[model samples]
Target chain A: MKEAAGRRRQSAAASPCAACKLLRRRCVQGCVFAPHFPAEEPRKFACVHKVFGASNVSKLLQEMAEQHRGDAVRSLVFEADARVRDPVYGCVALISSLHRQIQSLQAQLALSQAHILHLRMRRTAAAHLASGDHITSASASSLSLEVDQTARFY
Target chain B: MKEAAGRRRQSAAASPCAACKLLRRRCVQGCVFAPHFPAEEPRKFACVHKVFGASNVSKLLQEMAEQHRGDAVRSLVFEADARVRDPVYGCVALISSLHRQIQSLQAQLALSQAHILHLRMRRTAAAHLASGDHITSASASSLSLEVDQTARFY
Candidate 1:
């Protein structure tokens, strides 16, 4: 046990994972976060620690699948960075601003669609008027025939 | 001048407008906020004044048209209330949360639309197959007539 503790101390001094380093804990072999969060980028874990705290992060990582851990860590880091920068709203502010943009876009889209529908209706009405004028101009002898044709067309 | 001063003193003593009272200023006859922000509802102006400051609110009301002032004041009061509750995020947090809801709703709407389109396409395909079976069962003697009818229908 003493030899194992000495070896762990040597390993911890050499290269502790960011999470362990930030929390000032000894990083054991096959640590859960070691693969995803390396010892090189200390700031990543710092941000996450500040926002979510180390214990909650540990529980979260433990609950998640191994394959999904990397993505989860990435999301946490991003959210933490946002939280550090904007303590009040964090990522929520960005989402809100984006939502406002989408609303304005939707309104514009509705207006444009209405305008297109109006134009199509006007075009159809004009075409009908023009066809009616042609029928009116036709000989009186063919008036009944023209009317039947117009009725069929409609 | 003395008479005018006495009259002003009498009016000021009667009941100062909320904005002037909160800001510790004399409410003159032509005070801009007097008509909208009465002394009775001092809390409304208090919240607005705390969040936006009396000077900024005054400037904003002065710049806007009379028709828009009511809406501006309402918005200010609401924002101020939110700010008092959450000094960090304030109104921005509400905006951000609302934005998230909008995004989720939009995603749901898009998914529903896509599902509808998929269902419509499947129904159309099924209808086409059913019509094809009918065409195949029709008598061979009426094949040309059927073809002509189908062409016209198309």
Candidate 2:
């Protein structure tokens, strides 16, 4: 027990990487996650581990090539952050909320466009009536008025 | 070989639930998914299975309460539809697109409100300048003009 305690103290003195330290695991030499996830930002790994279990993350990192691991880690971190913030839906909620907003905005855009078109048509008709011009042969003044009104956006 | 063929025919005659059929598994007695997903709507299960794999969905269904299962299935279908439409981001893309739209709409709303406020303030300042009226002693007629302009919203 005394010898084991002494070895543990020595290992502690060496200072494990942030992930292993937070996870309370021994950071062995050639730890795959250490280089990408440093000791300073334990929260990054904490959120990732919380959402996608540490083992799964380990498996994913192990499966990917060295060149791709960095990007994979970044994507995982972003998704994990979204997941942690909204537990039930995680990133999905963000996506759904955004979808709803798009629907509403699209509706609003349609309405605004329709209103603009209606206003333009009404102005054209009124110009024709005021000038007493026929349907096919609208006066140049009425045409110019139509252009001016349509061009005047708000 | 004849006996195996007979057994396969027997199983096929039973007609598995949509979920089981899509997954190419036998729909045994008391399948949790059977009641919610009938055999007729194979496409429903196909989309759901395509977006969220069978095992994860099964696990999720198993974890939820019996009462909540129906609604959960419905939401899953909606999300799966969105996912299938946008494979790369799945539902996340819909959310992101909506979020971007919401941001833009919110910005537009703010601008419109600001413009209305600025217009009101200018009108008020002009009225004050024209009539030499004190801030608190403004007439009801001036306020009525503000209301009329705002009410003229198309």
Residue lDDT tens for model 1, A1-154: 9999999888666688998887788888878778877888989888767655676567667766778777667666765677567544456556557777778756544444444444434444455565675434444346445345434423
lDDT at position B69, candidate 2: 73
The residue ranges of model 1 lying beyond 4 angstroms of the native Cα positions read A1-14, A133-154, B1-154
Task: Estimate, for each residue in B1-102, the C-alpha lDDT of model 1 and write its tens digit.
Answer: 999999988865568899888888888877878987998799998876654457656766776677877766765566567656754445556555776766
- CAPRI grade, predicted model 1: incorrect
- Measured with C-alpha atoms, the lDDT of residue A6 in candidate 1 is 100
Error of 2 at B76 (Å): 8.8
Residue B96, model 2, lDDT: 54
- Model 1: share of native contacts present? 0.02
| Separate clash counts for every candidate | 0, 4
| Top-scoring candidate (DockQ) | 2
